[model samples]
Target: MDTRDLGCGYDFEVENSGHVFEVKGLSGDNGGVLFTDKEWSIASEKQEDYHLVLVKECFSNDPVVEVYSNSHRKFNPKKQITTVINVNWSISTSDLNYTEIN
Candidate 1:
């Protein structure tokens, strides 16, 4: 079943096997894959039941999919530090000049 829209952390789930898969698409044959905090957490918790499906050359005519089970143990993932900037501006209506447009 497709569960990506539900934000459950994984993309697809096998009903019979109860296994979850997270898919990553790349334009090139090989590259690094980054998972969100929630996804990483779920992958760690799911253990062998979690699968990381990497789709290579997704944009090309031919794409190849490689499935990795328990990827949390197969490879070490480094933490990616992200900087978030929040900008807020408060403008009073009195500071603005009104122009009439037809």
Candidate 2:
């Protein structure tokens, strides 16, 4: 994996893949930018800048799943975004249960 420093955070690129994952470490009420490509149609609809966190997983034997906070705020169950996991994959969410890492 290759890591690049974005102004507000960092981006991770998985080997041999077109996907680029970005992460922003801003705090409450702050907004930051994430990955952008020509095919990002969702960005075109917005008049203002939007922010997103990027991640990449290339070595998983099964489909990877992710759980993240919504609205770019701190982690909250009411604002969680959980990706559906395929039946062929088994995942453990215990590591990601915390809102912040100390």
Candidate 3:
């Protein structure tokens, strides 16, 4: 089932097998894929239950598909730090309240 929109960390899940998958699509056979902190954490927790599906040359007619179960055993992932900033605007009730409108 497609779960990418749910933000559960994984992209897809196998209904009966109880397997979760994260898919990485690459334009070419040799490329890199980055996982968010949440995704990495989920993968680590799921261990053997988690799977990574790599689609190399994904847009090409002949795409290569590779499935790696227990990705931790197959590859070592690096951690990257990204800075995020949130800007919010707020107004007090008093500011919007006026006794008379001109």
Clashing pairs for model 3 are: none
Judged by lDDT against the true structure, how good is candidate 3? 0.90
- Pairs clashing in candidate 1? none
Better of 1 and 3 by TM-score: 1
Superior candidate under lDDT, 1 versus 2: 1
Which pairs of residues have clashing backbones in candidate 2?
22-54
Candidate 3 residue-wise lDDT, 8-70, digit = tens: 989999898879999999999898899888888888888999999999999999999999998
Off by over 4 Å in 2: 5-10, 29-51, 54-102
Give the residue spans of candidate 1 off by over 4 A. Answer: 89-102
TM-score (C-alpha, index-matched) for candidate 1: 0.82
Compared with the true structure, what per-residue lDDT tens digits does model 2 show for residues 19-94?
Answer: 3444544333334333333213323332133224532342344423332423224322122345887677544587
Worst 10 residues of 1 by lDDT: 93-102
lDDT of 2: 0.37
